[model samples]
Target: MAEPFWLVRPRHDGGSDYVRFLPSQEAVEVREGSHLPPQMPLLKRRQWLPLKEAEDCRRHLQQEGGFRSSEPLF
Candidate 1:
């Protein structure tokens, strides 16, 4: 079985408007709860592709031109 990947959409402003990329169903449950870490935000994850597949896909995108050089270091 392949692991699942999610498309995390971070909350722009306040309120509830974000997404996350999780690994497992159990992880989803844990993520859904409001007991996450302090630094971590309260955004939810939207599953997109399998983890294994996503890994390969991400790698391919990076190898090609989908990856960015620098992502604005906070």
Candidate 2:
């Protein structure tokens, strides 16, 4: 199984960005904001990056970007 599943960047205003490392795809997938009230569709952004760059993003998100890492969304 893949390790260190996801990284989540949350905002003070109650919105969040969810990120996933897709090694096979050689990119990162970012889910912008939450799906609140079950009405608004979640927006997705993909970045084509190298493995090292993706890992760097994970590090930045966890340490400097104020993101919650690999935590349950419940």
Candidate 3:
């Protein structure tokens, strides 16, 4: 069986709903009558990227062009 079955709970205005993940089966289940909250965002699979990849992307961006959005950009 796959490990680390996560349950995504959407937090909204005043309530929350749950969405479960079955990693072993690669399935996702949305509960009934569970309305999506406005405050909570819908997370995509791409959003759950590895830290190494994120760091690599950051490094690449830094190399391409350092943070220039600020007045005293580095």
lDDT of each: 0.35, 0.59, 0.33
- Preferred candidate (lDDT higher): 1 or 3: 1
Error of 3 at 60 (Å): 0.6
Which residues of candidate 2, in runs, are more than 4 Å off? 1-4, 12-15, 25-33, 37-41, 71-74
Indicate which candidate wins on lDDT: 2
Give the range of the ten consecutive residues with the poorest summed lDDT in model 3. Answer: 65-74
Error of 2 at 61 (Å): 0.9
My TM-score estimates for the predictions, one after another, are 0.31, 0.60, 0.26
| Residues 1-74, model 3: lDDT tens digits | 13332232334455433322223233323222233445444434333334444444434544563321112100
Error of 2 at 9 (Å): 3.2
Query: Could you tell me the lDDT of residue 48 within candidate 1?
Result: 52
Candidate 2 local lDDT, 8-49, one digit each (tens)? 766565655676665655455443345333346365666656
Ranking by lDDT: 2, 1, 3
lDDT computed for candidate 1: 0.35
